[model samples]
Target: MADNTAINIENIYKKYNALLEGHFLLSSGNHTKFYLQSAKVLEYPQIAQKLALSLAALIKEHSIEVECVCSPALGGILAGYELARALGVRFIFTERVNSEMMLRRGFQVTKGEKVLICEDIITTGGSALESAQCVAQQEAKIVAFAGLANRGFCKAILPNNQKGNEGSKIQAQSPICKLPLSLPLFALANFSFDIYPADSCPLCKDSIAYKPGSRN
Candidate 1:
């Protein structure tokens, strides 16, 4: 079972609210009542240290025997580094190269190595899945996954029972049978379609001021 110490959903939310800003379209494409500006926390070494400690404690408690830690580039980079430090292991990240996410810059995962995938947040699990795929290509075993906030969607569960490939493709072989967070899954599609291109967005149609969402 996963440890509960690192999965502080409530504190994560409070910290998020403190850092969030104006109307934003999340990567999930949902109009969020809240946005998790992870960079705010990442930028503060003290806060980032605190979070890293929590994640390290959880790894110890769970006895997760991972050889390496991996995360998607950008948002997951900081957290992944912290977790790796806590675990005393090597850390690597996958990045989008020419529109596809892959492990570049000579990053290698030896076959049969145990890997723990981490993320800052999981809205649709797209980026994380891509990183997982890269790991799979190296024939590594993804022992488990960690995230600061799960936001209720199960990347393990597809909308139509479709199997999502963990590494090669964004499909899963089975519903995530195990996830640390316990929240109801609300389809991103169920929320109002508030996202729009610069010119065609409904917010623009109504003259609502737009705030730039984070690209990192």
Candidate 2:
């Protein structure tokens, strides 16, 4: 497969019917008309590998040194594993234990080891940041963050933020993202959808919003 562009990424999502349109609830407690159901596309291992390989190419291009890749379960496991396979790095995941992201199953990051936090789809980056903090607590060096798709909330962290072609596609950063602004974010595509707060959600007035995400 060729290196993926935003168009290619969008096409893949559409092909798999992963790009959903409806009044949906997000893990961030926000409401959006569209949602990128990455599991649909990731269900096919071959397609997952292609996406991961393309994403790995981007990290390699930046020469980002990553000793291991950590993702927050359960949404990110497939993408994270495939990415680790492509990059030839170790892969581990953090799960919510008492609502706290923790590395269990003997998965621990070594001090000073370069780590990359990944997700299948990055919206406000809350989950990814939580996993990053878990690594940081262990004194690991977080080299970067990545996802299969960016929801355009943290466009400021995009490495090519200044490039007219790519930058223009993403809007200015919103306050929703909790990730540090200093770290770079790599994603295959940007999906900018209209998100609304619960009180202001227009969809809520007419129909009940559905929570279609993995998190509670």
TM-scores for all candidates? 0.67, 0.92
Who wins the lDDT comparison? 2
**Candidate 2 residue lDDT tens string, 105-182:** 999989999999999999999999999999999999999999998888886333342244353234566788887777
lDDT of 2 at 70: 96
Give the poorly placed runs of model 1, Cα more than 4 Å off: 1-21, 155-216
Local distance difference test scores for all models: 0.59, 0.85
lDDT of 1 by residue, 1-216 (tens): 223333444455466564453455665443443456666667777666666666555555546688998998878898788878767899999988787889989999999999888777665666777788899998998877766554444543212222232321232322422332332211111111123334454444444543333442
Model 1 CA lDDT for position 131: 86
- RMSD vs true structure, all candidates: 8.6, 2.7
Residue 129 of model 1, lDDT score:
70
Q: In model 2, which runs have C-alpha deviations exceeding 4 angstroms?
A: 5-7, 156-171
- Show pairs that collide, candidate 2: none
lDDT of candidate 2 at residue 27, scale 0 to 100: 88
